[model samples]
Structure formats: C-alpha cells, structure tokens
Target: MQINQQIVLVTGGARGLGAAITTTLVHAGAKVVVNYFKSHALAEQLQQQFPDQIFIYQTDVTDKIEVEQMFNAAKQHFGQAITSIINNALVDFKFNGEDRPKLTNLQWSEIQTQLDGAVHACLNTLQAGLPDMQAQHFGRIVNIGTNLVQNPVVPYHDYTAAKAALLAFTRTTAHELGEYGITVNMLSGGLLQTTDASHATPQVVFDLIASSTPLKKVVSPAEFADTVLFFLSPWSRVVTGQNLIVDGGLVKG
Candidate 1:
C-alpha cells in the first residue's frame, strides 16, 4: 500500500466522505489535491493543517473547462504527473425523506442534477486525467458509488440510476484503458453514518438498515475511505473495473 511520492486528486474533497478520503491519502504519504466546489473555508482550513502535503482548488467538476483548470493547477503545484483520483463529490442528496421524489413525478432537472454529479463529474475527471496517467504509464481511478443501486429498499431513483451508470462507465473505461496500465474501479457503500448527506436520512430508516446488516452498524466515512485508499495503493494493481461494495455485508455482490 505504499503511495510515497504519488500525487492524488479527490473531487468534492472539501467535506464528508471526500474529506475523509483526502485526509487518508495525505496521511498515506501521497501529495493530495483537494477539489471543492464551494467549501472554500473548510478546504483552506484543511490545507493550513497540512500545509506541505495538501493543496486545495475550487472546480465545478460538471464543467469541462473547470475540471481541466483544476487538474492544471494541481499539476503546477504537485508536478505534471498525477497518479490517482477519487471521484467523491456529489450534488444534493435532498431526496431523503419527505422530499423524496417519486419516479412518476421526478423532474428532468432533478435527474440531470444527479447525473451531473455522478456521471458527468467522473467523465470530466477521466477525460482530463487519463492522458497524464497514460503518458506516465500508471494510474488509479476509484469512483464512489452507493449501495442503493443494489438494495434500493429506500428507493432513491435518480441517485441510484446515476450511480449504476457510473459503475458501467467505470468498467468500460477500465477495459479501454487497461492496455495503457491504468486501472479504474468503483467503491460502493451503504448508509454511511455521519456525513452531511446521511444526515438527511430518517432515523428509523437508518436504524433499520443497521439492525439488518450482518455487522449491525452503519459504516463511517473513514471506513469507506480505507477502501478507496486501498484501491489507490500498489497492492490493487491487478484489480480493475470491479465494483467493491463495503456496506457491512448488507448487500453481498
């Protein structure tokens, strides 16, 4: 799991699961670029805490130009070659409780927003980061997915659909890029206990999930971060295009 001297980029790295991933990468001896859309204050605070190891940049990953600029800025700071990326940023996870939209009433705008965060963000990062990895002949990409796509007991139609699409894209890209020594994989988890996104979930819903799981508990962001870091490390070189679910054995794939 040695990542010494590697430069890693994490989208939506300002807070929540993304923040956990960023912290893990930095602590693992990799130079980390934390990409945030609006959490400038938190990003700056994190950078201040790890001045020499962590860098922060603001970019809307849904936009091509912004994504390119983020990579360029990161390269300028961390050097031209980035070795890994963690796609963890997402739009609103507001469809949790009373606000959840039924499939019949789901608006195109709502669907598009989720798609922008899940699919488009990954596309932007892959398009921008692949060339550098290809040129360097080594790269690791880990896209964050959700357990809802498998269980769907709660039924977040838009979010689940978008993540399913992300998994498909990750597999296709992994196959296409394997010849170049680049590995693309996905990490999917369920009901992370203490993130801003998970806060929207109802207490009863979360409790049910926890009790039903073999582990009888929800996962922490740091726990999920561990899996992402594993993928980035040298140990996972032979693993690619697979969706690894870390949901307390709630959904066995």
Candidate 2:
C-alpha cells in the first residue's frame, strides 16, 4: 500500500500511541479515520491540527454493531473502501506495574476486561472490515501488541496475557486472509516514554528500562508509531503474520 494512496482507520486514536499513529498517517498523506470511545474534544482538536486529512468517529471497536458502522461510515465519508486498518484502540489501562495484580491475587474479571479490550476489540474490527477487504482483494491490518508478552520484565500478568491472545489471533487471521491480499501483523513495543498510560510508571522503572535497552533510551510513542507505518506501507507488502518488536532490541523476537 502506498501511504498517500490508502484510506486508513485507527481505533483508539484520540490520545497517546493511537494519536501518534494517526498523526503520522495523516502527515504521510493517507486519509485517516480517528476512532475514539471518548475524548470527543481531543478528537476535534486533532481534526483542527491536520485539516482535511482525517475524520473523527466515536465508536467502541469492541462492539460488533459499532465496528460495522465505523467501516460503513468511513467508506461514505472517504468515498473509498478502507484499504488499511490499525487496531490501536486499547482498553483503558495505566502502566503502573507496582499496582498491577499479581497472579495469586489476579481477578478473572481483570483479565477478561483486558481480553475484551485487546482481543475482542481486534476481532470485532477485523470481521467488520473483512468483507470490504475481500471485495477489494487488498488490505493491511496492524495490531498493537506489547514486548511484555516476550520479555515480560515487569510481569504485568493480565495485560501481557491479553496481548498474547491478540498475537495468536493476528497470526491466524493473517493465514486466512493472505490469499485475499490482506496482511495482518503485530507491532510490539516496550514501555513508551511519556504517554498518558506510561506517565503513571515510576521514574525508577523507566531508568532501569533505558539502562538495559541497547539504545539506552526508552522508546517514544512517535517512534513506535513510525514502525507501524512500515507495516502499512508498500515496503512490507510481502510480510504478514509476524510480530515486529520495536523496543530497541529489548526483546530479541
């Protein structure tokens, strides 16, 4: 896919990592749909920042009906089938490892919530978009994953488990969709520097991560978002069902 020639939809695009991805896509000349569950004002602000490049829609990616409606509305608004989709919408979470539930004390509901937010959300969006992608016989899907699933240095039980589930689904879907010319992949990153979610992370933890990373610095959301662009662009057309870890060599996989 040519960045400037694709119609893109990014879920959870109102703030943080999603926001960075949306901005990068728009600037690269792709027409982007910004999907948000809340933060309408922030969405509008993004609209004003980059005029005529994006459409803001408030929808929950976890809901089948809403996901279908978003894709439909995107086609109507952009006058083209969405050629690329970024499943970046995350369920609300703060990256405070200290407060995260340990295995012995973890509640099923907590795990379920993460699953709903990550895995279920991806399923809803992928299913809703598949028909259009099949009709076009061309599409790109990128799911945001985490390095924790591989490195898991912090031991965020529920969160890492949910991301692992998403990775499994990503690969399975890619295999099924490969014949249709749609590629599915995951871009996993380590602790981002200062996103709303990571702001809650302790400075000591950040220092530890930076010191241990090959780059000796925490990955920024913008940097992670740029890696997402690679999957969406023509350079990666032959690649699918792979997890590209963009954590400065933190996790070898």
Candidate 3:
C-alpha cells in the first residue's frame, strides 16, 4: 500500500502517539479513521484540523463486533476499503517506576488487563480488517510497542510482558498473512519525551534518557509516527514480521 493512497484506521487515534500518526498520515494524503474509546473532544479537534480526511468512530477495539463496525463505517465514509492500521490504543498506564507494583505484589488481573489492551485489541482489529486487505491484496499492520520489552530500563513488567506477547502475534500473523500481500510489523519506542501518558514523567528522567542515548534526546511521538508511513509505503512491500525500535539508537535490534 502506498501511504498517500492508504485508507488508514488508527486505534486510540485521538491523542498522543495515535493523534500524531493520524495527522501525519492525513497530511500525506491518506484518509484516516480514528477508533477512539473516549476523548470525544480530542477526536473532534482532529476533525477541525483535517475536516475532509479525518473520521472518528467510538469503539472498544477489543470487541470484535465494535471493531468490525468501525471498519465498515470507515469504508462507508471514505468510499473505499481501509488498507492499513496502526494499533496504538493503550490501557491506563504510566511510566512511574517508583509507584509500579513489584513482582510479588502484582496481581494476575493486572497482567490480564494489559494483555487485553495489547494483545487482544490487535487480534480484534486484524480480524476485522484482514478480509478487506486480502480482497485488495495489500495491507500494512503496525503495532505500537515499547522499548521496555527489550531493554526494560524501568521494569514496567506487565506492560513489557504484554508487548512481548504482541510481538509474537506480529511475527505469526506476518508469516500467515504474507501469502495475501499483507505485512505485520511493530514499532517500539522508549519513554516518549511528551505524551498524555508521559506527561507525568519528570524532566530529570527525560534528561537522563537524553544523555544516555546516542541522539542525545528522548524520542518524540511525531518522530515515531513518521516511521509508520514507511511501513505503509510501497518501499516496505518486501518486509514484514519485523520489530523496529525507534528510541534514538538506545537499544539496537
């Protein structure tokens, strides 16, 4: 799928990384549908920014029915099939290492919730969009992940474990979906300098990360979002089942 012509669906596209991806893709000439569970104001704000190219659908992406409904509505609104998706929706989480529960105190329910948000949500969106992608012979699926899965600098155990599982899904789906010209991949980023989720992070932490990285700065949501366009572009037609970490070379794959 060429990005400029891609009919894209972005989960949790109302704010943070999702919002950046949605807007960047829109500016590149792709019509974007944002699947938002909340933040109606944020969703509406995007509408004003790209009134003709942005569409908002309220959906819990873990629900198969709701995901399918969003897909159908997007096609109806855009007058074409959605050719790509960026699974960036997240359950409530923060990067506070100090307050995070230790392994001994962590509950199974905590782990389960992260799984639902990271793994199952990807499953729902993929199932809903795969048929259309197969019919069209092109698809680009990018799951937003975290650097913690690889480096674990902060030990967000539940979050990292869930993303690791999501990577497994990315690879397996890429293997199976290859025959249909569909590519599945992941983009893992470190503590983004600024996001609604990362707003709680202290400046000292950001400075420490910046000084540690080769680029001398923490990754920004917009910077990571730009990489998404690459996966959707025809340039990556031959690539799939890969994990690309975009943390200013803090961790190499």
Candidate 4:
C-alpha cells in the first residue's frame, strides 16, 4: 500500500524519535494513532499540529490489556485496521552510559525491565495486531533497535541485550508471517544526536562518535525517522526479517 493510504499505529509517538516518525507519517497523509505511556500534553500538542491525520491515545505498551485497548481505539478512530506499526517506544530507559551500572553491579531486575520493554511489549502489540494483518493479508512491522548490538562500545548491557532479542523476534516473525503477506524489519541506529533518552549522553561522547563515523556528524532523530518510511512503503514489500543500521556508516554490517 502507498504511504498515504496507510493507517499506522506508533507506540510512544508523543516526543523525540517517535514524534519525528509521527510527523513524517502525517505529512505523507497517513492516518496515525499516536500511543503514549505518559506525555499526554506532548501527544495532544502533536495532534494539534495535524488534528485530522493524528489520533492520540495514552497506554502503557508493556501491559497487554492497555495495548489491546489502544489498538481497538485506533481501529475505531480510523475505521480500519492499522496497516503499519512502528514500535518506537523506549520504556524506562536513558542513554547516560557513564552512569550505567557496572557489570558486577547490574541487577537481574534491570535486565528484566529492558526485556519487558523491548520484547514483551512488542509481543503484545504483534499479537494484538496479527489478526487484522492476517485478515487483510498486509502489514508492516518495524522494531527500533540500536547499533550497540553490533558495536557495544558503551556496553549498555541490558539495553543491548534486549534489542538483540528483539532482532531475533523480528526475523523469526517475518519468516513465519511472510506467507500471510506481512513484513517485519528492524532499523538500528547509533547514538541519535539528541532525544529525551539520549539527552543525558555527554557532549564529548557525541563528538567522539561523530569523529568516527563517515558522515562526520551525529544522526538526527529526523534522519532515523525518515528511514521508517521505506519499511512502510510498498517499495519494501519483498524486504523482511532484516536489520538496517541507520547510523551514517558507523557500523557497515
């Protein structure tokens, strides 16, 4: 389906990278359901910018019941099943690596929290959305990931491990759902220039990354957001179960 014809549901679509993706979709004429856990004001503000194209819903994605309610509301608002989903939510996370718990100090609960955000939340949405996608024989699923899985320079143990598990989920789901005409993919990016999550990152870290990448600058949330368009577009119908790194040549693989 063309972008303009799509009905997309973006989790955590109130601010930062999620907001960027929501804005891009609205501009492309797609009807979007912007789901947020908190950020009600920001979500409302985003809806104000394009009231007709954006519908805002408040729900914690990690909760199965909340996710179901969000999807039901989205379908009712759009009068159609969501044709695309961008799992852009970063539940309970910050990018201040310097303050991250040392390996010996990290708790299992911390890793579990990341897993709940990355894997469990995604599972809830996928299952909730699968029926409609199977009925229509069309769907696009994009899971946001990090380059740290490949190059764990900062070693965000819990975050990286959770995303790695998500990548595994992405490919396996794509393989299983391919016969039904659904495509699942991942977009992995390096430290984004600045997002609510990344804002705590030291400026020196950003500069160090920029100096190492071929682009000679940090990638912006908008840049990462734009890449999401391809996965949703019909042009990517045959592309599935793949991770596309969007870190401006920071990780070639």
- Per-residue alpha-carbon lDDT of model 3 for 118-216, expressed as tens digits? 999999999999998999999999999987888988877888999999999999999999999999999999999799889888899999999999999
Better structure of 1 and 4 per lDDT = 4
- Cα misplacement distance, residue 188 of candidate 1 (Å): 0.3
Query: Can you write out model 1's per-residue Cα lDDT over 72-134, one digit (the tens) per residue?
Result: 888889765667888899898763757789878998888789999999999999889888888
Worst ten-residue run, lDDT, model 1?
A: 90-99
Judge candidate 4 at residue 237 and give its lDDT.
Answer: 92
Comparing candidate 1 with candidate 4, which one achieves the higher TM-score?
A: 4
Q: Model 4, 18-123: lDDT tens per residue?
A: 9999999998889999999889999999989899899999988899998998889889988998888899899788999779877999999999999999999889
Output the lDDT of residue 233, model 4. Answer: 92
Sort every candidate by lDDT, greatest first: 4, 3, 2, 1
Model 3 regions more than 4 Å off: none
Q: How accurate locally, in lDDT, is each candidate? A: 0.88, 0.90, 0.91, 0.93
Off by over 4 Å in 4: none
Against the true structure, candidate 1 reaches a TM-score of 0.97
What stretches of model 2 exceed 4 Å from their correct place?
none
Candidate order (TM-score): 4, 3, 2, 1
Which segments of model 1 are wrong by more than 4 Å?
Answer: none
Worst 10 residues of 3 by lDDT: 1-10
Better of 2 and 4 by lDDT: 4
Top of the candidates by lDDT: 4
What's the true lDDT of residue 114 in model 4?
91
